[model samples]
Target: MRIDKLHTIDSTNSYLKRISKEEDAQEDIVVWALEQTAGRGQMGTTWSAESGKNLTFSVFRKVKRITISEQFYALMAASLAVKDVLSKLLIKNVRVKWPNDILTDNDKICGILIESVIKRGKLDAMILGVGLNVNQTEWKDTPRATSIKSRTGIHFELEEILSMLLKQFHHYVDLLLKGQFETIKNDYEQHLFKKDKPATFIASDGTQFVGIIKGVSETGKLILLQEDEVVNEYDLKEIQLLY
Candidate 1:
């Protein structure tokens, strides 16, 4: 694993993507920025963090043997890694809010954005961008946002947390590489927020409805058990889970 610390960057994910194409980038290349001028979350959402007060970074991983059909494992691996780290830190109720948000006690503490490089209809590599709230306690507009310090009431060293998270990443991604599909999938679902409980959802058409998150589809779509015993799959752009 190679880590490059940047005092400042526009976006660590963007920077790593450019460098991976321009040069020969290896797996586990991490670019951590102290400040991201323009960080992003899933689906073009802006990720705002107080400068130097959180964890904002991206890690590059080279894909092998994992086909496009199995790419959802990447998300599972990364999300599980974050949950693992938070659990180690004694964060209560650590759960993965599907697709990529990490939550504790129904409050968001981290967000992940994954970008992949595909060639010839096969998975090649991916950049996992993570924004984790750390010591920052002040939040404006985003009421559900929380941090490690806020939950634990104890300050943490950013580097120590980063190291622990990266180690978990290595372990989980290795499991994915080793073709432990069922194991990873089961672990991810077990940590899913509201796995069986009824929840409210808003469709892209602005229609609000109720559904139960059963699990995730193989292609990463959300599986919802809806009205009249109906089972449906919705992509990221199709539906939003109302927290």
Candidate 2:
């Protein structure tokens, strides 16, 4: 694993993509940035993190023999990797929110964004970007954001955590490559946030409803048991889970 340390960058994911195109990039190359000026999250939201305070990095991994339908396994691998790292640090209440936001208790501590490159209906490679709130202690405008130090009141070395993450990430990705779909899915659901709990959800059309989160479908859809004894699976664009 080669880590390219950067003082500042617009986005680590973008940089990795560029380097993978320009340079002869190899697999497992990590690009770590001290600051991200234009970081992004799911749903076109901005990922705001203080410079030199958080783990904002991306990893480029070359995939083989994986299809687009199997892409959700990559997400499961990444989420489980982060959860494993947090649990090893003794961070209690670590749960993986649907689609890939990591929450401890009620506040978000990490976010993952994975980009895949497909060719001829087959998966080529993926850029896995992670934004983890590590030592940052204060939350100014973001009320739901929290960090490891904020949760545990103890500072952590960013590189150490990154190393741990990479190890766990490789472990899960290897499992994915070996076609262990059921194992990964079951492990991910075990750490799923609010699983089997009744919660409110707002659809994309601004309609709110209550449903119990059963788990996720094989293709990464949120499987919700509705009030009228109907179970429906929704994509990311179809619904937003409300705490």
lDDT of each: 0.91, 0.91
RMSD of 2: 1.0
Each candidate's TM vs. the true structure?
Answer: 0.97, 0.97
Residue 120's lDDT in candidate 1: 76
151: Cα error in model 2, Å? 1.6
User: Tens-digit lDDT track for model 1 on 1-243?
Assistant: 889999889999999999998886765799999999999888888899998889999999898678888988888999999998998899999999988999998899999998988877878898999999999999899989999999999899889999999999989888988999889888888888989999999999999999999998778898999999999999999999897
| Candidate 2 displacement at residue 31 in angstroms | 0.4
RMSD of each: 1.0, 1.0
Provide the lDDT at 167 for model 2: 91
